[model samples]
Target chain A: MSIRIDQLPRDKFIMPGTAACPGCPLLIGLRQVMMALNGKMSLVIPAGCSSVIPGMSPATSYGVPTIHVPFASSPAVASGLVSAVRMRGNNGPVVVWAGDGASSDIGFAALSGAAARNEDLIYILADNEAYMNTGIQASGTTPWMAWTTTSPNGKTEERKEMALIMLMHKIPYVATASIAYPLDFIAKVRKASQIRGFKFIHLYAPCPPGLKFDDSYTVKIAQLAVETGIWVLWEYNQGKLTISPPSAMYKDKSKRKPLSEYMKLQGRFSKVGEDAMKIYEAKIDAYWNTILKLSELYK
Target chain B: MQETIQRQARKVLVGDHAVAEAVKLARTQVISAYPITPQTLIVERLAEMVDNKEINAKFIRVESEFAALASVYGASAGGARAFTATSSHGLFYMYEMLWWAAASRLPLVMAVVTRSLGPPWNIHDEHTDIMAIRDSGWIIGMAQNVQEALDMTLAAYKITEDSRVLLPVAVGLDGFILSHTAEVLEVPSQEVVDGWLPPRDPHIPYVIEPGGEPITMGNMVKSDAHHMLLKKMMDEAMDGAKNVIHDVFASYAKLTGRNNGDLIECVNCQNSDYVAVATGAWSGDIMKAVSDLREEGYNVGFLRIRFLRPFPEEAIMDVASRARGIIVFDRDYSTGLGGIIAAEMMGLVPQSVSFKGVIAGLAGVDVTPSEVKAAIKDFIDDAERNGPIRIRKTWLMQKMEGGKP
Candidate 1:
């Protein structure tokens, strides 16, 4: 379905001409998420490209109060910001928008702690696969068989499972979304504002620069990720499970595009063989089955 | 200097609970804490009070020491009076945000139960934990007792909220010594405590507001000029905290019928030649030891440091100029350096005075009044016969080597 600009919320979150690269998926994801969240939102960005995307000076696109904290402190900082809002009797929702590097790697300790404590806030991880801000460095979330400066011949392990780890905390809300599905992303973020206990939203954002793909392919790649069962859309809420139905790309599983297409676009995954691909497939299947079992148990 | 009036009141209360009561009296709007030994009582009391709606503040149970401080920082930056508590290991855990709170100029206040740093897994009174992050830009204060801890907590707000000194403060109290020991505390009326520290202003804007808005906080701006400008402001505020702390103590004195002075207090050194300088709870023992030595015709004095961070240099210099010998009792080691306080005192005094580094009571090691007396006698005898003890580098290094890995 072609998205209509008029159908989208008319409100502007980040003004035009911001520092985000021309086809940055995080910027697009942030714009929609902010619009859905509406007024009175505190954004805590940890150290990463998305954290610095607001720009330093002369030009800033974000229309709300955004604070960029240290790399490992986004969740902790957001928890503080949320408590401050509560202390001040402010009804505004506290939101944390962190990159995968900051959220899954350096920030894991703080993030896990905040979720376990059930701090009243919404934390969103804009996962662009790797640490795009630091020249496409491999992070814990960097998929297996993904190449990067450090992971010269593709990543050796499976991506870190962040959402499930947060789920173990029994948070009030935890959901996954992709920029390609704006409505789902917006709905989850907007709903997160109404909830009380800790809520997390993981957005699968495509990076043209980091992925070494054409700038215009950002949205298409995001769609392909979800449809390929590579980035599933699901939520764990109070031990309950809810998965968004597959999109058009998953209508025919037999004709589903190969994972190689996604890997071929990104420089981080330039090298891969049958052995590595098999391991990747097995990991994905196991993760998928685990999610299915969780859904069954919770349902 | 003379033996002064001591308001010796007896009461039994855990250190954490006492500090919590003080925090309550100060009317902190946000109370955040994570459970850690020697400091858990402080948060538990606040949490119970919050559960019963005894205090108007929100009590948030954070996951880690880092989150506890981060929550306080956020709330404080949002213009609410915020507080948190942690001990040794916890303090080390929150080191990063401790600096963040200070550098951002948030009027955040925290109580640190000084416990020995880990390795041997001991939970006892030691200054090493708090002193480890001394340069993290916090206005540091040492509490001699529960009452002092209570009073200093309010004083922290007075110093931090003062426009001239908008910096975070960490009020340190010895862990097992001050935290677990019970003592009679003259609990002031809520009305009086409220009057002493006014309600926090709610309208002040935070560095960051909700919903992706932009605010000029620790923003990355162009130019070294901007960098130095912020640093200069922070430096100026720290300089201003000295007078602000004194004034805050003065106001509290008026309300609570107590008085605290800056720099060092001279006890029994009026016509004496020797003085022992100490801080925190040990000062009481040191003073008693000095009084006994004075009765024996031994000219002895006690210099009690009221403020540790903005080290009262002028007052220290004045006291050292008069005293012939100085014995510095320090509870924290610098690891490769001498006792933290002893090293600091050495730099403050003139070379003429004999200085003895009495490094004891570390990691909650017991130091009784008699031990203080012995140290004082040794210092006086050395001063009278061989002159001032010459400075030694290897001794300082030896002190460092004693630190636990």
Candidate 2:
């Protein structure tokens, strides 16, 4: 199920040099998305790191047509774009590149509306846990015990189960991907582009600055997250839910890495106490249980 | 589009229905709206038309007023003529996106069923909602009656999509008064509107589409002057829109045999003693009041300020200069300031005119012709006797049990 680096497209849609910081996982994921779609999709982005990552005005890093919309209106905007594009008898896909804060919290209603309408567009939420663009504030999907600016002593609430919520929508596709697994995400994007419905991809992106990790360890942190079984990489296709290739071996609890190792690498979890860790671990276990249960759909 | 209906015909419809009729004629490709009071009927009718295939359009039932406007903004950017409808709270809900559309300079039209903002849940007519967007780089047109509501929808498309003025347009018709009330209006054939408003040129300026040179919008601009220049361009467009509105109105009138005036409709205000100014549903009553006052030997004339943005400043000034008195009837307020319309007129009208900005119909209570006539008579006498008087007062329908304390 894995493709070699040589199989990836040689022509890059995203030019080199952007406002993105070193070891930024968003650029990696965005690059993969553009490559997967062959840079033919119209992109709608709400306010997020991607908005600034496109470089400044007059010069854009993206080599594809893009639109910037209001913070909470990306999904609906994409729905509208698809409508207008198809009206002109063009079959090009309208893709929405949104962030966690936009998709899960502020833009939740619009996200739900687009899904309910089953709009023919792909919506990928690059979830970096918090509102990183706005100075690392707590977002709806900020993990339990994650110490964001607003959640001074670690978040008290459980992180929202957005992927599962999206899966419940029963759209043609719903996926959870990590930036560390570029081939996996690229594969999903290629698969989803062919499905004519609301396709949601919740990407597990690690932030270097926001999470206070070493800039070079961004991909390492994301990999640690998956190995700890905290960020499950899976996809719900048609009526079947299955664990993806990279994460296939890590499904067993015994094979998972130490949760402390993942938490210790990121400073966002610095304030996480023993009690908070217990709560966080419990939540992770519960998430895995549901994901594991759903994996038996086609077994 | 498949011609289901042909030829011009006279039909009596409510303001909401008239807007729906015009939208169908405009051949809007994409429609997105969320239901709100008074505004609901326009979308309801449009949805019915879409469902029945009377009009070929993609109607998206958005979740909120915010999303409703957002969809149209996206659709417009995606090279389609788009439309939406909302009311007071709904407009306010779309406040952020309104700036997005205005700044992006998307050419589109929206019908605002004018309604009072809610504190105690009032669904009646008021001008506060549309008035709040005066500075928001949108051409705001107020329709006095049902006919104007239908005509203005097409006119709005013409003005908004014009190469010179590529901005959003909001055609506001008063709630319950024009919105729910039925009246006779001429519904022109799609061919007529087609002749006036040519198909929207998808590449007038730009569009977000697939397989194009990658261009980013709404990114960081380093220069303050660059940001200010965008605002300046909007102002320049607004200033230039006066002629565009006039030409569009004249062209529309030439074809349809009905003209809802150019920018401001001068009703017998040519060298009259004083002009009574107002807009929306109340302006129709104000016109009646002017006639009533004239029959009563007052010789008062009416000036209905239709396009509130690209605010007919020169037109208002010219009329005010001719007469020594001008009383502005405002159905909307400005919080710490006086009536909204009156406040606008106070700055533009000549120093010679006895300008009185009167705040009336705050909560959409009936502002009848007789009440307006009485107020105008008093205003006329005050202007004649007191000469060049300037003041703002509320024409209260009620007061404390005892009298004005």
Candidate 3:
């Protein structure tokens, strides 16, 4: 299923003057998701950059109803909201908009539980690689050798494979998208919305302040992530897998751009040595191999 | 207004079952919970009701107590009457969401089957679990038996949903003792409960609804004064609950012909030299002890403290002022500080009235009626000899190693 740019809704659900930093990809990605949802959804946002983007009391940038839950209970809260809506005889979608720290670390138990139960809700994880809202602490999703406030000397481990983790839950839908590709992101959301059971969409969002990059490079960095094969764009519907466009071009390792093209654009990996990058490359290769194995299951 | 009294049927039920019956009668729309000992029966019963279509509600079997309460918070904010149940460590896991439910001013109900917190892993009747959250801006109440557990669960919705007191309420019942003990409970008819407590008015400004104006809930307050003001509003809501609790109790009595006497239930305090204060199922033993002492020509009375959060200061003072001394029986102890209830009562009761804090029933150790009678007799004998008991606190089951009594 593909979304046509001309068919996209013109109305903006995200109002101006949010707390988002200049050129933050999360803001851009959020706008697309909200637009696709078109004010017909209720959001459960956990503590993260997106949580603060809604602004303070008596002022919210969201044009739809939003409940800000704790850092680890977004999925659980969404579960309750879904049940409540069903009890009211309404089947409108309930969405959990959370960050990497929430989805990968503190909130993993609840998220896994909701997925295992096949809850009828859509969970969108905007992965900025670190805990950006709390001063860029190293999170479970932070890439190998990435610098964060807590991991200032570069982290010692590779990023967690959360999208693959969600796939293992064997839910109805699981997808990965990037902020640079709005059409693809919106298309996946529209697809997931049509499903009945648990659906997860992993979004690669860029943070300017936390990543130590110029605000204008948000889109460039997000795009380079996919071009370099560091962030893959794909969807898992039922058991079938399809890599989205642009990212699908990198199906062959020889066709992908050098990893340095993505790493050099952000200061987070400035101190990273060649050995770490090689290890990261190996990890990415292993990840893609697993995805290939999963893709072959439905054939 | 002329009230029409409708006949309701009574059913034999345990404390856990009674709570489930009350939650059903209140027409809770959403129930989310994780099973813990003692409290598991309540959730199981609720799940059966939801599954059998006897209760038109959503039962969410969440992963943890944190998720359970968070789900309930979400459901409540979505303009639905929500509920959950937990005990001991489960309540501790829900500590964070308890504040969220209260500060968000969502009127949800949670039944706490009181159990001992463990390192030694014991599941028995203890008040420490509920007492831990006494200041979490929630209206707290405890039941003396299965009947009160049922009645209080019904009244909790009315008190919590009242506009003046839009806070969460936890109805506590002692683990095993009351939770598993069977008794006859008057299950109020649906028509009578509906007439007494109407469906929750979904007028909360922040509730998310279709076509409703978009709003951000549980937002950050930058200013210290603003944060303090929100807490102050919670405190004021708790203070305002005194009247709301009484009004609900009166209305429930008019409907069900049962009254818990609003906050505290006192017996034979009119002409007593000393009064025994207790809560939970053990309050029955204290009342029997009071009767035993009365038969022995001792001026003893019993006061069952139902609500612990709004502290029932006035009723406590009224009872304490008339007595020469007050003996507090606490089933839970606050480490380093002694009994929590005794600590709270020390400030409220007149200093002129001698007070003694007896810590007993830790980890479900039974505080038998004879034991209670002996304790009160000792207090009375001491007061008669020394003008008032000199000891501030006593460990009821403590035995001296050297055979010193």
Candidate 4:
């Protein structure tokens, strides 16, 4: 179930010289997914950073048919496209590339409905954890104690466990991948494209401007996030959930790099107090434990 | 032509069922719907028809009204003839996507089974709901009865799919008044509908395909010029729809010999002393009142404004200029601006014509032919005594909100 390093597609469908910020993880993830799909998918994008990145009017960066939907309607709109295509006997998958804000906050109802109906779609929720496109506002999936425009003094609420929430709908495939691990994300996208029903990929994308980090540190920050057990890499294929290779070693808490090591790289965690840190760590521990339980229970 | 008549069938149906019948006859490819009161029956009939294999279409049952319209929008963009139905709050909930559909020029057809919006939670009829989206660039029309609802919906598909007017059309039928009221409906053969309304050209705006050449729809441009031109095109289309509506109505009449009306239907406006103007099912009541008044030696006329977006200015001007006065009966009020239909007439009619806006039948209050006759008589008596008034509006409610106006 692994793709060799040399076997990756040469053509990254997302052309360079677009509007993406320096070290934009969404762009990276978009390129990987497009490469995996090989530009053979109709894209349904909602309001997010990718909306602008895919190119504005007369020119497009991606060499595929893309339809920009409203902020809250990517899944439902894709459901329509899929249905129409299926009616025409064209069983090609329609992919929805959306941000955490659209999928987790404003568009949760549509997202849930699409999952429940098992609409044939590959919905990639590119999670930057905040409304980065709208200038770093807090969203439902914005992490606990993360500094965002709306959650100015550290968020009052914990971020939602969206991957687990999507899994609860019993979709055919649910996976979590980070931009730091392109091979894993590419493999997940490739696997998902073969599935018949609703398949969701929670892509962990980092934001340099939003997270108060340097442009050069984007990949390193994402790498630290995975190493520190902040973002777990796993895949729930059909009903069997298994932790992916990139995150398997971190299952043992002691092997994980120090949480402080990961936090110091970003300014979002700068003002995080000891009490907030303890709560944040506890939430991460609880989340991983729950994932472990779910993987076993489904197995 | 003879073969087309052989496919015609007659059925006793409510407005909702009639809409379903029209959609089937038009051979709609994809239908997405969410159930709302007053509009629920339309989808229910459509669902059964789809399941029973009576109609070959994809019936998508969506979670909300927003998704209902959004799905159809996507389907239309994907080169399929699509439809959706909703009412009142449902229409309001789906309101944002309606602009998307209209602006994209998707040629979608939506039936608004019109109902009064809530709190104190009412479920009956009102034009205030449908009139809310007048400026939304959609081709808007109101059906006077069940038969008109069927014919109008079929014509809506033809009108919207026309190359000159590649925009969506919303045909509104009053809540229980039309949606639930059963009447004899003459359904033209599928062959006739197919001959009249061809399948939508997928390349109008271009359809989305997997392996097809790359096309990005609705992308943000640096300049507002293209966006401005799109809105300008909508205006041109609205103007251009007048000819399409007439042409469609003419061809449809020739095929079925049932020429209901086009844009605005008038009754005896030729040198009439006064012309009563209105829309919706109450137009029938107004017409009866005009006929009664004409028999009583008063040269009065009735004019029903069919299509709202195009406004039917020329026809309205013809009737308005000939009459000594025009009494606009509106079932909808624009709140701070008096009646909606009244406001349109007030803006359009000749400056010399005496005008009065009689706002009535809001929130499902019944306005019979006698009440309409009485209102017309009151307006004539006042106009006969006084000279031509510039603009006047009167509230015709039993219990005026904070007392009489």
Q: For each candidate, what's the DockQ?
A: 0.50, 0.77, 0.63, 0.75
Which regions of candidate 2 are displaced past 4 Å? A273-279, B1-7, B400-405
* Candidates ranked, most accurate by TM-score first: 4, 2, 3, 1
Better candidate by DockQ, 3 or 4: 4
Error of 4 at A277 (Å): 2.5
Candidate RMSDs in order: 4.1, 2.4, 2.0, 1.6
TM-score of 4: 0.98
| Model 1, total clashes | 27
Candidate 4, B1-405: lDDT as tens digits: 565555578789999999999999888989999998999999999999999999889987889999998888888877788999999999999888988878888788999988887786999898999999998989999999998999999999989888899989999999999999999877897777788888778777678877666888888986789889878988998999999999999999878878877888877775788989888898888999989998998879888888888888888887877779999998988878898888877867777788999888988999889989998988888888884875557888676598765
Specify the poorest-scoring 10-residue window by lDDT in model 1 chain A. A246-255
- Fnat of model 3, as a fraction: 0.55
The model with the greater TM-score, 1 or 4, is 4
Sort every candidate by DockQ, greatest first: 2, 4, 3, 1
TM-score comparison, 1 vs 3, better candidate: 3
Error of 2 at B113 (Å): 0.7
The interface root-mean-square deviation of each model, in the order shown, is: 2.6, 1.1, 1.7, 1.0
Q: What would the per-residue lDDT of candidate 2 be over residues A1-299, giving only the tens digit for each residue?
A: 46677877888888898899999999988988988888988899999999988777777888889998889999988888889888988888788999999999999999999998999999999988899998999999987778888998888887788988988787989999999998999989988988999999999889999998999998999999899888889999887889998888877888988788999988989987778777777777888888888888644
Ten-residue segment with the worst summed lDDT in candidate 2 chain B? B1-10
Ranking according to lDDT, highest score first = 4, 2, 3, 1
TM-score of chain B of each: 0.91, 0.96, 0.96, 0.96
Off by over 4 Å in 1: A1-7, A15-22, A57-61, A235-242, A245-252, A278-299, B1-12, B203-207, B211-213, B263-272, B392-405
For the predicted complex of model 1, DockQ is: 0.50
